[model samples]
Target: MAIKYKVLPRKNPRDIAAPEKFYAAAIADGDVDLDRLAELISYQCTVTATDCYAVLHSLEHNIIGELEQGRIVKLGRLGNFQVGISSEGKDTATEVTTTNIVKSRILFRPGKRLRSMLNGLTFKKAG
Candidate 1:
Protein backbone atom coordinates (compact mmCIF):
# COMPACT_ATOMS: atom_id res chain seq x y z
CA MET A 1 0.00 0.00 0.00
CA ALA A 2 1.09 3.57 -0.63
CA ILE A 3 0.81 6.75 1.45
CA LYS A 4 -1.85 9.18 0.30
CA TYR A 5 -1.24 12.92 -0.05
CA LYS A 6 -2.94 15.94 -1.52
CA VAL A 7 -1.70 19.12 -3.09
CA LEU A 8 -2.25 22.34 -1.16
CA PRO A 9 -1.72 25.97 -2.03
CA ARG A 10 0.45 27.77 0.52
CA LYS A 11 1.92 31.25 0.46
CA ASN A 12 5.54 31.95 1.40
CA PRO A 13 5.91 33.42 4.89
CA ARG A 14 9.07 35.42 4.11
CA ASP A 15 7.67 36.81 0.85
CA ILE A 16 4.00 37.62 1.31
CA ALA A 17 3.80 39.18 -2.19
CA ALA A 18 4.87 35.91 -3.82
CA PRO A 19 2.20 33.80 -5.48
CA GLU A 20 0.95 30.75 -3.56
CA LYS A 21 2.57 27.50 -4.65
CA PHE A 22 1.16 23.98 -4.54
CA TYR A 23 2.73 21.54 -2.07
CA ALA A 24 2.12 17.86 -1.43
CA ALA A 25 0.92 17.06 2.10
CA ALA A 26 0.38 13.54 3.37
CA ILE A 27 -3.16 12.68 4.48
CA ALA A 28 -3.43 10.52 7.53
CA ASP A 29 -4.89 7.08 6.86
CA GLY A 30 -6.31 6.58 10.34
CA ASP A 31 -5.36 6.15 13.96
CA VAL A 32 -4.44 2.98 15.83
CA ASP A 33 -4.66 3.35 19.59
CA LEU A 34 -2.86 1.23 22.16
CA ASP A 35 -5.59 -1.41 22.38
CA ARG A 36 -5.79 -1.74 18.60
CA LEU A 37 -2.00 -1.89 18.37
CA ALA A 38 -1.83 -4.69 20.90
CA GLU A 39 -4.41 -6.67 18.93
CA LEU A 40 -2.42 -6.25 15.73
CA ILE A 41 0.83 -7.30 17.36
CA SER A 42 -0.80 -10.37 18.84
CA TYR A 43 -1.66 -11.59 15.35
CA GLN A 44 2.00 -11.34 14.28
CA CYS A 45 3.53 -13.19 17.23
CA THR A 46 2.97 -15.81 19.90
CA VAL A 47 2.13 -13.27 22.60
CA THR A 48 -1.47 -12.84 23.56
CA ALA A 49 -3.14 -9.45 23.21
CA THR A 50 -3.33 -9.04 26.99
CA ASP A 51 0.40 -9.71 27.39
CA CYS A 52 1.30 -7.41 24.56
CA TYR A 53 -0.77 -4.63 26.10
CA ALA A 54 0.84 -5.13 29.49
CA VAL A 55 4.35 -5.08 28.07
CA LEU A 56 3.63 -1.98 26.01
CA HIS A 57 2.23 -0.19 29.03
CA SER A 58 5.26 -1.17 31.10
CA LEU A 59 7.54 0.02 28.30
CA GLU A 60 5.90 3.44 28.38
CA HIS A 61 6.30 3.81 32.13
CA ASN A 62 9.92 2.64 32.07
CA ILE A 63 10.87 5.00 29.23
CA ILE A 64 9.48 8.02 31.12
CA GLY A 65 11.16 6.91 34.35
CA GLU A 66 14.54 6.53 32.67
CA LEU A 67 14.24 9.85 30.87
CA GLU A 68 13.41 11.65 34.14
CA GLN A 69 16.70 10.32 35.52
CA GLY A 70 18.62 11.88 32.61
CA ARG A 71 19.18 8.69 30.62
CA ILE A 72 18.51 7.88 27.00
CA VAL A 73 16.14 5.00 26.43
CA LYS A 74 17.19 2.79 23.54
CA LEU A 75 14.78 0.24 22.13
CA GLY A 76 17.20 -1.61 19.86
CA ARG A 77 16.22 -1.43 16.16
CA LEU A 78 13.21 0.70 17.09
CA GLY A 79 15.58 3.57 17.88
CA ASN A 80 16.24 5.66 20.98
CA PHE A 81 14.45 8.41 22.87
CA GLN A 82 15.81 11.23 25.00
CA VAL A 83 14.69 14.47 26.54
CA GLY A 84 15.47 17.70 24.72
CA ILE A 85 15.13 21.26 25.95
CA SER A 86 15.22 24.83 24.76
CA SER A 87 16.49 27.47 27.17
CA GLU A 88 17.01 31.20 27.32
CA GLY A 89 20.61 32.39 26.96
CA LYS A 90 22.37 33.50 30.11
CA ASP A 91 25.19 36.05 30.35
CA THR A 92 26.87 34.34 33.28
CA ALA A 93 27.39 30.62 33.93
CA THR A 94 25.90 30.83 37.45
CA GLU A 95 22.89 32.78 36.20
CA VAL A 96 21.52 29.77 34.28
CA THR A 97 19.20 27.38 36.06
CA THR A 98 16.05 25.32 35.51
CA THR A 99 14.17 28.64 35.28
CA ASN A 100 15.94 29.32 31.98
CA ILE A 101 14.38 26.26 30.36
CA VAL A 102 11.55 27.32 28.10
CA LYS A 103 10.48 23.98 26.73
CA SER A 104 11.09 20.26 27.13
CA ARG A 105 10.36 17.57 24.56
CA ILE A 106 11.01 13.94 23.92
CA LEU A 107 13.15 13.26 20.86
CA PHE A 108 13.11 9.99 18.99
CA ARG A 109 15.82 8.91 16.54
CA PRO A 110 14.67 6.21 14.14
CA GLY A 111 16.97 3.22 13.78
CA LYS A 112 18.31 1.90 10.46
CA ARG A 113 15.40 -0.49 9.95
CA LEU A 114 12.82 2.22 10.47
CA ARG A 115 14.78 4.64 8.28
CA SER A 116 14.96 2.06 5.46
CA MET A 117 11.23 1.41 5.77
CA LEU A 118 10.59 5.14 5.35
CA ASN A 119 12.93 5.25 2.34
CA GLY A 120 11.02 2.39 0.67
CA LEU A 121 7.58 3.99 1.04
CA THR A 122 5.51 4.70 -2.06
CA PHE A 123 3.07 7.59 -2.28
CA LYS A 124 -0.22 8.02 -4.11
CA LYS A 125 -2.06 11.27 -4.59
CA ALA A 126 -5.31 11.35 -2.69
CA GLY A 127 -8.48 11.55 -4.76
Candidate 2:
Protein backbone atom coordinates (compact mmCIF):
# COMPACT_ATOMS: atom_id res chain seq x y z
CA MET A 1 0.00 0.00 0.00
CA ALA A 2 1.13 3.53 -0.73
CA ILE A 3 1.35 6.32 1.82
CA LYS A 4 -1.37 8.90 1.18
CA TYR A 5 -0.85 12.64 1.15
CA LYS A 6 -3.01 15.70 0.68
CA VAL A 7 -2.15 19.05 -0.84
CA LEU A 8 -2.69 21.77 1.74
CA PRO A 9 -2.15 25.50 1.51
CA ARG A 10 -0.30 27.09 4.38
CA LYS A 11 0.81 30.65 5.07
CA ASN A 12 4.50 31.41 5.51
CA PRO A 13 5.25 30.64 9.16
CA ARG A 14 8.23 32.99 9.32
CA ASP A 15 6.52 35.93 7.69
CA ILE A 16 2.76 36.38 7.55
CA ALA A 17 3.02 38.83 4.63
CA ALA A 18 4.65 36.18 2.45
CA PRO A 19 2.49 34.38 -0.10
CA GLU A 20 0.89 31.10 0.87
CA LYS A 21 2.25 27.88 -0.57
CA PHE A 22 0.83 24.45 -1.17
CA TYR A 23 2.53 21.52 0.49
CA ALA A 24 1.96 17.80 0.51
CA ALA A 25 1.10 16.53 3.96
CA ALA A 26 0.60 12.95 5.02
CA ILE A 27 -2.98 11.79 5.53
CA ALA A 28 -3.43 9.02 8.00
CA ASP A 29 -6.17 6.53 7.14
CA GLY A 30 -6.49 5.13 10.62
CA ASP A 31 -4.63 4.36 13.82
CA VAL A 32 -4.04 1.03 15.52
CA ASP A 33 -4.60 1.11 19.28
CA LEU A 34 -2.64 -0.83 21.88
CA ASP A 35 -5.17 -3.67 22.09
CA ARG A 36 -5.19 -4.06 18.32
CA LEU A 37 -1.40 -4.14 18.28
CA ALA A 38 -1.32 -6.85 20.91
CA GLU A 39 -3.85 -8.87 18.96
CA LEU A 40 -1.72 -8.63 15.86
CA ILE A 41 1.33 -9.83 17.74
CA SER A 42 -0.68 -12.68 19.18
CA TYR A 43 -1.77 -13.71 15.71
CA GLN A 44 1.84 -13.86 14.58
CA CYS A 45 3.15 -15.80 17.57
CA THR A 46 2.18 -18.64 19.89
CA VAL A 47 1.58 -16.22 22.76
CA THR A 48 -2.01 -15.61 23.81
CA ALA A 49 -3.54 -12.15 23.35
CA THR A 50 -3.69 -11.51 27.09
CA ASP A 51 -0.04 -12.48 27.52
CA CYS A 52 1.04 -10.33 24.57
CA TYR A 53 -0.86 -7.38 26.01
CA ALA A 54 0.90 -7.81 29.33
CA VAL A 55 4.30 -7.82 27.71
CA LEU A 56 3.50 -4.73 25.65
CA HIS A 57 2.13 -2.92 28.70
CA SER A 58 5.28 -3.70 30.65
CA LEU A 59 7.44 -2.51 27.77
CA GLU A 60 5.61 0.83 27.64
CA HIS A 61 6.17 1.37 31.35
CA ASN A 62 9.86 0.49 31.19
CA ILE A 63 10.48 2.71 28.18
CA ILE A 64 9.02 5.67 30.04
CA GLY A 65 10.97 4.89 33.18
CA GLU A 66 14.27 4.75 31.33
CA LEU A 67 13.57 8.03 29.49
CA GLU A 68 12.60 9.91 32.65
CA GLN A 69 15.89 8.81 34.28
CA GLY A 70 17.87 10.55 31.48
CA ARG A 71 18.80 7.32 29.72
CA ILE A 72 18.70 6.64 25.99
CA VAL A 73 16.58 3.60 25.22
CA LYS A 74 17.49 1.41 22.24
CA LEU A 75 14.63 -0.77 21.00
CA GLY A 76 16.43 -3.08 18.62
CA ARG A 77 15.40 -2.40 15.00
CA LEU A 78 12.76 0.13 16.07
CA GLY A 79 15.37 2.72 17.01
CA ASN A 80 16.69 4.77 19.92
CA PHE A 81 14.72 7.21 22.05
CA GLN A 82 16.27 9.87 24.23
CA VAL A 83 15.18 12.89 26.19
CA GLY A 84 15.82 16.26 24.56
CA ILE A 85 15.43 19.64 26.18
CA SER A 86 14.74 23.24 25.22
CA SER A 87 15.90 25.81 27.75
CA GLU A 88 16.26 29.50 28.27
CA GLY A 89 19.77 30.91 28.01
CA LYS A 90 21.62 31.93 31.11
CA ASP A 91 24.30 34.60 31.30
CA THR A 92 26.61 32.37 33.29
CA ALA A 93 27.17 28.66 32.88
CA THR A 94 26.63 28.10 36.59
CA GLU A 95 23.38 30.07 36.47
CA VAL A 96 21.77 27.53 34.19
CA THR A 97 20.03 24.59 35.84
CA THR A 98 16.97 22.40 35.63
CA THR A 99 14.78 25.40 36.34
CA ASN A 100 15.86 27.01 33.10
CA ILE A 101 14.63 24.07 31.08
CA VAL A 102 11.46 25.09 29.22
CA LYS A 103 10.42 21.68 28.11
CA SER A 104 11.64 18.14 27.61
CA ARG A 105 10.97 16.25 24.40
CA ILE A 106 11.59 12.73 23.23
CA LEU A 107 13.88 12.27 20.24
CA PHE A 108 13.84 9.19 18.05
CA ARG A 109 16.58 7.96 15.77
CA PRO A 110 15.29 5.17 13.58
CA GLY A 111 17.43 2.06 13.32
CA LYS A 112 18.94 0.96 10.01
CA ARG A 113 16.20 -1.57 9.27
CA LEU A 114 13.36 0.89 10.00
CA ARG A 115 15.04 3.75 8.15
CA SER A 116 15.66 1.56 5.13
CA MET A 117 11.96 0.79 4.93
CA LEU A 118 11.40 4.42 3.84
CA ASN A 119 13.51 3.87 0.73
CA GLY A 120 10.99 1.51 -0.84
CA LEU A 121 7.91 3.38 0.27
CA THR A 122 5.54 4.70 -2.41
CA PHE A 123 3.27 7.72 -2.09
CA LYS A 124 -0.13 8.49 -3.54
CA LYS A 125 -2.42 11.52 -3.42
CA ALA A 126 -5.40 11.23 -1.11
CA GLY A 127 -8.81 10.91 -2.70
Candidate 3:
Protein backbone atom coordinates (compact mmCIF):
# COMPACT_ATOMS: atom_id res chain seq x y z
CA MET A 1 0.00 0.00 0.00
CA ALA A 2 1.21 3.49 -0.87
CA ILE A 3 1.27 6.48 1.45
CA LYS A 4 -0.99 9.31 0.42
CA TYR A 5 -0.27 13.04 0.27
CA LYS A 6 -2.10 16.21 -0.54
CA VAL A 7 -0.65 19.13 -2.37
CA LEU A 8 -0.81 22.34 -0.38
CA PRO A 9 0.03 25.89 -1.30
CA ARG A 10 2.33 27.44 1.27
CA LYS A 11 3.66 30.98 1.32
CA ASN A 12 7.40 31.33 1.50
CA PRO A 13 8.22 32.59 4.97
CA ARG A 14 11.73 33.75 4.04
CA ASP A 15 10.68 35.80 1.01
CA ILE A 16 9.11 39.25 1.13
CA ALA A 17 7.74 38.61 -2.35
CA ALA A 18 5.33 36.12 -0.87
CA PRO A 19 5.79 33.56 -3.61
CA GLU A 20 3.50 30.57 -3.20
CA LYS A 21 4.95 27.10 -3.38
CA PHE A 22 3.26 23.74 -3.44
CA TYR A 23 4.39 21.03 -1.10
CA ALA A 24 3.40 17.42 -0.71
CA ALA A 25 2.13 16.79 2.80
CA ALA A 26 1.43 13.23 3.80
CA ILE A 27 -2.17 12.51 4.69
CA ALA A 28 -2.95 10.23 7.56
CA ASP A 29 -4.54 7.04 6.28
CA GLY A 30 -6.09 6.12 9.56
CA ASP A 31 -5.55 6.04 13.28
CA VAL A 32 -4.76 2.89 15.27
CA ASP A 33 -5.59 3.37 18.91
CA LEU A 34 -4.12 1.42 21.81
CA ASP A 35 -6.68 -1.36 21.74
CA ARG A 36 -6.33 -1.93 18.02
CA LEU A 37 -2.55 -1.88 18.30
CA ALA A 38 -2.61 -4.49 21.02
CA GLU A 39 -4.85 -6.73 18.98
CA LEU A 40 -2.48 -6.52 16.04
CA ILE A 41 0.52 -7.37 18.19
CA SER A 42 -1.28 -10.34 19.69
CA TYR A 43 -1.95 -11.78 16.23
CA GLN A 44 1.76 -11.81 15.42
CA CYS A 45 3.09 -12.97 18.77
CA THR A 46 2.42 -15.53 21.48
CA VAL A 47 1.43 -12.86 23.97
CA THR A 48 -2.21 -12.20 24.51
CA ALA A 49 -3.90 -8.91 23.66
CA THR A 50 -4.30 -8.12 27.32
CA ASP A 51 -0.62 -8.58 27.93
CA CYS A 52 0.28 -6.38 24.98
CA TYR A 53 -1.94 -3.64 26.33
CA ALA A 54 -0.38 -3.90 29.75
CA VAL A 55 3.16 -3.70 28.37
CA LEU A 56 2.37 -0.76 26.10
CA HIS A 57 0.68 1.10 28.94
CA SER A 58 3.65 0.46 31.19
CA LEU A 59 5.95 1.82 28.49
CA GLU A 60 3.95 5.00 28.28
CA HIS A 61 4.23 5.54 32.02
CA ASN A 62 7.98 4.95 32.08
CA ILE A 63 8.63 7.24 29.11
CA ILE A 64 6.96 10.14 30.86
CA GLY A 65 8.72 9.38 34.15
CA GLU A 66 12.18 9.44 32.54
CA LEU A 67 11.43 12.51 30.47
CA GLU A 68 10.37 14.34 33.65
CA GLN A 69 13.83 13.63 35.01
CA GLY A 70 15.35 15.32 31.88
CA ARG A 71 16.44 12.01 30.37
CA ILE A 72 16.13 11.08 26.71
CA VAL A 73 14.17 7.89 26.10
CA LYS A 74 15.38 5.73 23.24
CA LEU A 75 13.06 3.22 21.61
CA GLY A 76 15.38 1.08 19.58
CA ARG A 77 14.50 0.62 15.86
CA LEU A 78 11.71 3.18 16.29
CA GLY A 79 13.17 6.46 17.48
CA ASN A 80 14.58 8.53 20.30
CA PHE A 81 12.37 10.91 22.22
CA GLN A 82 13.52 13.83 24.33
CA VAL A 83 12.14 16.90 25.94
CA GLY A 84 12.59 20.26 24.22
CA ILE A 85 12.02 23.64 25.74
CA SER A 86 11.40 27.17 24.63
CA SER A 87 12.53 29.95 26.96
CA GLU A 88 13.09 33.65 27.13
CA GLY A 89 16.68 34.69 26.69
CA LYS A 90 18.62 36.51 29.38
CA ASP A 91 21.43 38.96 28.84
CA THR A 92 23.44 37.55 31.72
CA ALA A 93 23.88 33.79 32.14
CA THR A 94 23.23 34.05 35.88
CA GLU A 95 19.94 35.87 35.26
CA VAL A 96 18.46 32.86 33.52
CA THR A 97 16.07 30.88 35.69
CA THR A 98 13.28 28.34 35.52
CA THR A 99 10.76 31.18 35.33
CA ASN A 100 12.19 32.02 31.91
CA ILE A 101 10.96 28.71 30.49
CA VAL A 102 7.97 29.24 28.25
CA LYS A 103 7.00 25.78 27.05
CA SER A 104 8.09 22.16 26.90
CA ARG A 105 7.65 19.74 24.01
CA ILE A 106 8.49 16.16 23.10
CA LEU A 107 10.91 15.73 20.22
CA PHE A 108 11.21 12.45 18.29
CA ARG A 109 14.06 11.47 16.04
CA PRO A 110 13.34 8.41 13.86
CA GLY A 111 15.88 5.60 14.08
CA LYS A 112 17.58 4.22 10.98
CA ARG A 113 15.06 1.41 10.42
CA LEU A 114 12.10 3.76 10.60
CA ARG A 115 13.79 6.31 8.37
CA SER A 116 14.74 3.63 5.86
CA MET A 117 11.08 2.67 5.50
CA LEU A 118 10.40 6.20 4.28
CA ASN A 119 12.68 5.62 1.31
CA GLY A 120 10.47 2.77 0.11
CA LEU A 121 7.22 4.60 0.56
CA THR A 122 5.18 5.36 -2.54
CA PHE A 123 2.88 8.32 -2.43
CA LYS A 124 -0.46 8.95 -4.08
CA LYS A 125 -2.55 12.12 -4.13
CA ALA A 126 -5.29 12.25 -1.58
CA GLY A 127 -8.87 12.75 -2.71
The top-ranked prediction according to TM-score is 2
Local accuracy by lDDT, each model: 0.96, 0.95, 0.94
Could you estimate the TM-score for every candidate?
0.85, 0.91, 0.88
In angstroms, give how far residue 103 of model 1 lies from its true place.
1.6
Question: Over the stretch 1-127, how does candidate 3's per-residue lDDT look in tens digits?
Answer: 9999999999888895887989999999989988899999999999999999999999999999999999999999899999999999999999999999999999999999889998998888989
Q: What is the full ranking by TM-score, best candidate first? A: 2, 3, 1
What is the C-alpha lDDT profile of model 2 across 1-127, one tens digit per residue?
Answer: 9999999999988999999999999999899977999999999999998999999999999999999999999999899999999999989999999999999899999999889999999999988
Can you list the residue pairs that collide in candidate 2?
A: none
Task: State how far residue 2 of model 1 sits from its true place (Å).
Answer: 0.9
Cα lDDT of model 1 by residue, 1-127, tens digit: 9999999999999999999999999999998887888999999999999999999899999999999999999999999999999999999999999999999999999999999999889999999
Ordered list by lDDT, greatest first = 1, 2, 3
Q: For candidate 2, give the lDDT of residue 54.
A: 94
Provide the clashing-pair count of each candidate structure.
0, 0, 0
**Candidate with best lDDT:** 1
Q: What's model 1's lDDT at 123? A: 100
lDDT of candidate 3 at residue 46, scale 0 to 100: 100
